[model samples]
Target: MGLEADDSSSPGETVMVVMDANRSRGNVHAIEWALRHVARRGHTVLVLGLLCEIGKRASCFPFHMGEKLERLGEGEVDPTELEEEIARKRDEYKSCLQPFYRHCKKNEVKLESKIAAGLCPRKVTVDEAQSCNTCWIILDSHLKKDKTYIYAHVCCNLALVKGKDVVTLMPSKVILQKSSLKHRRVDDALLSNEPITDDQEEKSITPPPKTCCWYPLAWRTGFPRYFTQSELEVITSGFSEENIVQTQDNVKVYQGQFQETPVLVNCFSQNDERFWSMLRILSRVRHRNILNIVGYCFTGSSMFLLFDFPFMGTLEINLQNDDLAEKILWKARWYIAVEIGACLRYLHEQCVDGLIVHLSVCSSNVIYPLGGSAMLANFMTAKCLKDGSPGDNQSLTHCLNLQEDDGIAIDVHDYGIFLLELITGRSARCSLDPDKEDLIDWALPAIEKGSLSEVRDPRLTDTTDDRLIHHMAQAALLCLQDLNRRISMSEVLAVVRGHEIARPGC
Candidate 1:
């Protein structure tokens, strides 16, 4: 009953059951239940298994040297070996579906198995769902809200199947329970046919009354919690000076623990409106390159925003630390550059609402977590253009007070400067002499003359690849162009990936 091709069955409806192959056993059982329900209704089921290989998507840049170095300690890949690996993956996917095939055969149900590999699995799933006359899509309930939003719009009907345990654990029921069963002894509940004596009735004890605790509606919805002043004080130890990691005019950032989770608390004493606006923007954005906002609090004239603290600190800090600088390999530096470019691309293009402009795209705002890539943070100055509205070209130009192409071009300019810093292993503010304080001015001419070695940092001389060094320098020069001539973040990414080249007015 396994159909590999399109089914022209006009008599029955089609049910698409999407599952992640990497999910736990419980999720597999949930998928089985969904399949049984659809089959019982005399409909055909299409089970799509998503193969999500970390850092192996089509859009991902292949780090051949890094992979080979990790596996063989330094070697080149053989073409035949790579082909064998791909064939092995295909065989493994087929083996994974053997149990599903057998189940469909035993139940006399028609089933089709498909394997999808891509950068965005949800996009692939949506494409598959639209390929046929699909009536309904049954997906796992463990998907994030942003991931599931598209499925609802693309499919005719979508049903989320949850595990039994998840469905049974009702938070309201647990919070509203009136009595505790632990308080009563087993013998106290026993009933006998014989009449009860006065002594037995007097000896019987009355159970203690139950207490009811109230929780806010926000707690149930998954929106940021409205934390009380007392709770904030307790978490940050009354905003102790020792806990403070950074302090600026009217603002202080403290490293604190909330509900046993490490969090960064930013206490602001001014510009409350701006803080709330930033919070709204952060709440709408969900991406790996962006910092995760846990929650926020507003009390009287003071405001606080919570974020998941990055253990390794900011990219600026790492660049300044000689010990850490030596550990950041050439491959890691290239990966970090690409990641920052991707973040800017998401803010400027991929957002569903409209475009977002990060007014500040400097290295100080780039945080390096416990991962190979970097994340962009500090969105206090970000601006967004809502859908269905005219472009904010004037506002963007006025904000930056520059004759740039737009707000996005300003980001490209800042990111270009960041790339220069990454390549030269020097701060953007670092100067070889008094007059050459600006890195862009000092390095642009050299990069234009193809003197990459002269501009590159001496620290990276031993490990740097000349080709990559040249490409990065060329991209940096492109980013430093005039307002109307600078390239977009997407174009910068394309050039960095070697898919495109930079040319003026192209």
Candidate 2:
């Protein structure tokens, strides 16, 4: 097993990377880059080597590949066969990881290694990493030159299952390893489409925009300034536990004020490495419904991502009172649906490239305003197109094509779940009890079975907006489909936007 951390361990300090040991050479390079990047800033790193049997599990090897090979040779079945292969592969993989381990060790880079044997390498790696407060994951793209998906599917599967922040480093298109791979230039995908009107097309097609780096302009010119620990402490009231608004996967969110502006402090568990990339991505994205990243602090190995504090907190808390979810008028409910749809539209179209998927969108992440509107937060579990990298044009094109169907579809599914949450005032996947293992699981059965009114929140039942309710119910049904034939965001938006009521065209 790769390096493992026990229960009492800090969560965000160590960076655990799970990759194919057979591709240890490429992974080793990635680990080195991570270590150097983190170490230069004085952060510790952990590299986990997961050794998983391919095509079959360790138990099946003898019966499958080894037994066949032996029978062809006309030799006796070797009982020690599987163990010998495991031992040999383990040794070979260890040797491959040794050089990088030694380099980090020599530099006092604070690195650790662990080896794990399992059938579900990706799940096992993610599970093991989660025990130590992993906040971000960096994966190498598994696409070969033929444009056929390589390990990209593996990485995507892991991301989909885990719903965490993951960044994939792509290969330069010029170094095409597969002759059949078709990489489109990024500009053609992001700029040439011209989503803006004719008058605005010139502005949209202009030169590339400036990169939004977090460091201040003065610091970019060499005048660096940082918040002193003592100052930060006073500024944040000593990171007061009472300031904490929510906690998820070892991340504690605290509401505070920085220079009289509302700020939410996200103190991560120690082992998370994706903090930088997460912060970078969130900082660059601008959307009304999405939570805004105001500023952040990276002190040693720890990070505190500061965001615009959502005064309303989360829908989970708001609905717990029973009054807000039920007492909120139909107009307010419709307003929320419309606003959230608008937010998704912005994420789909207004971004530099194509769509950015909020892989894990749920009630817990939906923050409602005490008055005005609601917004989505928790980008620690989001993914976006590569905007400024060398092969960005190609990546952008591929991402745009992918968004044409896949990305938007996934988002529509997520938003449909959100709609269900709004209607039922319950989680999409509930675990409180059998009665509520997600509103979808419970209400969906009723919805399918024709208990229309019963499946809806009693709060919304009193309202006589049959067409709107029917449309929303239908949209949710389309979204809940496990197949790719689910409704698209544009389609959902069209239905929800046009059917829903707005106050006197305001």
Tens-digit lDDT track for model 1 on 140-174?
65543323333323524454555532211111113
The most accurate candidate by TM-score is 1
Superposition error at 460 for model 2 (Å): 4.2
lDDT of 2 at 435: 61
213-330 per-residue lDDT for model 2 (tens digits): 2111211111123445565577578988887777978787877665554566777765464465466566566444566665567666567776655666687776666776776555
Q: Score every model by TM-score.
A: 0.58, 0.49
Q: In model 1, which runs have C-alpha deviations exceeding 4 angstroms?
A: 1-226, 387-405, 431-436
The C-alpha RMSD of each candidate to the native structure, in angstroms, is 20.0, 20.5
Clash number for candidate 2: 29
Q: Residue 312 in candidate 1 has what lDDT?
A: 78
